[model samples]
Target chain A: MVTLGHFLLFSGLLMAVGLYGVLTRRNLIAVLMSVEILLNAAALAFASAAAFREPHLFAGQIFALFIIVVAAAELSIGFAILLNVYRTHGAVTDDAISEMRG
Target chain B: MSLTAFYALAAFTLVFAVFAVTTANMVRAAFSLAITFFLIAGLYLLLGSPALAAIQFMVNASAIPIMTLFIIMMTRSRSSGAPRTWQIAAGLLAAAAALVFFKGAVGHHDGQINPVSPELLGSNLLQAALLPFEVASVLLLLAMVGAIALARRRSG
Candidate 1:
């Protein structure tokens, strides 16, 4: 039988994979993709918790829904920012934009 | 709950996610991401919430990847190149840290798993989470407008 611990551990591994991508990826768009992975891992954790633990309120599922909404909003905004960055720098790599580096 | 099915789904999901992040080709990575999310929706169904699974399949598995592909096309970024050696080290360290943090945060909880029906979730949304639902709508509108304004060309 699969336990809640199993689900949580799976989510953690997913998060670790996403974190690695976010930390190492050079392209800003790849970074955005990693961020989406992170968000999905979080939503998975929420849904699993709601299924296994929170029986009465089922708050975890609702939280997952909101997380999805926020992720969509965040992606649009982040992509727009990336578009502007590309227009200005002519490349989407993180090294291309270093004007703020002090 | 079927343990074998869960294991199979989890393994596929992780493999696709790893490919999504590690692949040099941008289009392949995006497609891998879409596949990973679609598999995650299957996991959601196993977790007993079909509504969330359906939404995940539609919004995350479909719409997000299409948008990502569009961005990739518009920017003309085909390959992201390779990470530097130091970046690989940093990524390994970060992954280790994240694993440790999440492992510590997860408490042992063995209980009766119940399937959440759509009606119950819907009723709770309108009754308990009504405020958040409204706020999310406004937030989506804001994001749509903001994206359009920000991406628009400046005219003299």
Candidate 2:
């Protein structure tokens, strides 16, 4: 029997993996990929909750949908900015764009 | 049936995700990410949300990874360097904390899985979520314009 707890556990595991990537990865694009994983983990949790426990069946699904929309928008903006960063800095690593440091 | 599928899919999802995060080659990582999202869409199917699964497959599994690959190619970021020892330690700590934080949500709930149809989802989107839906469209437009403006070559 696949229970809500099982889904939750899976989501948690994904969250852990994504968090590790975000915290460790040096490439800016790699970091963005990690953030995508993190967002997916959250969407999974919301979707499972919608499937299992939401008072309104579609509520969690709606939330997940919105999450996807937001993630897409965020990615477009982030990648655009990353492109500009690469143009100015000639590299895309975290260490490459440290002009703000005192 | 689905339980076994879930286990298998979840394992593959994690494996691909780990590969995506840890691989040195950017193109390989993007492909791995695509596979991971595709498996995740399968998980959504198991959760009885085919509509969600379709959307996930289209947007996350397809578009996002393609965009990632485009950026990787455009920027010429072929391979990223390995994480430093201190960074790895910090990542482990953060991962542990996330695991602990989500542990509280692992309670028993004997809820039945109701398959959500696209019609129902559409109605819900049009009825209750109308405002947010409209807002989301506007947000998408804004993002498109913003991205073009940001990424376009400008005259000096």
The RMSD of every model to the true structure, in order and in angstroms, is: 1.3, 1.1
**Please, what are the lDDT tens digits per residue for candidate 2 over residues B1-156?**
878998999999999999999999989999999999999999999989899999999999999999999999999999998999999999999999999988877775645787788899989899999999999999999999999999998889
Candidate number with greatest TM-score: 2
Runs of candidate 1 exceeding 4 Å displacement: B104-111
Tens digit of lDDT per residue, candidate 1, span A1-102? 777887888999999999999988889999999999999999999888879875777899999999999999999999999999999899999889988999
lDDT of each: 0.92, 0.93
For model 2, the stretches where C-alpha displacement exceeds 4 angstroms are A54-57
**Model 2, DockQ value?**
0.78
TM-score, chain A, candidate 1: 0.96
- lDDT string for model 1 (B67-88, tens) is 9999999999999979999999
Question: In model 2, what lDDT does residue B142 have?
Answer: 100
Candidate 2 residue B58 Cα shift, in angstroms, is 0.6
Interface RMSD, per-candidate values to 1 decimal: 1.4, 1.2
Which 10-residue window in model 1 chain A sums to the lowest lDDT?
A49-58
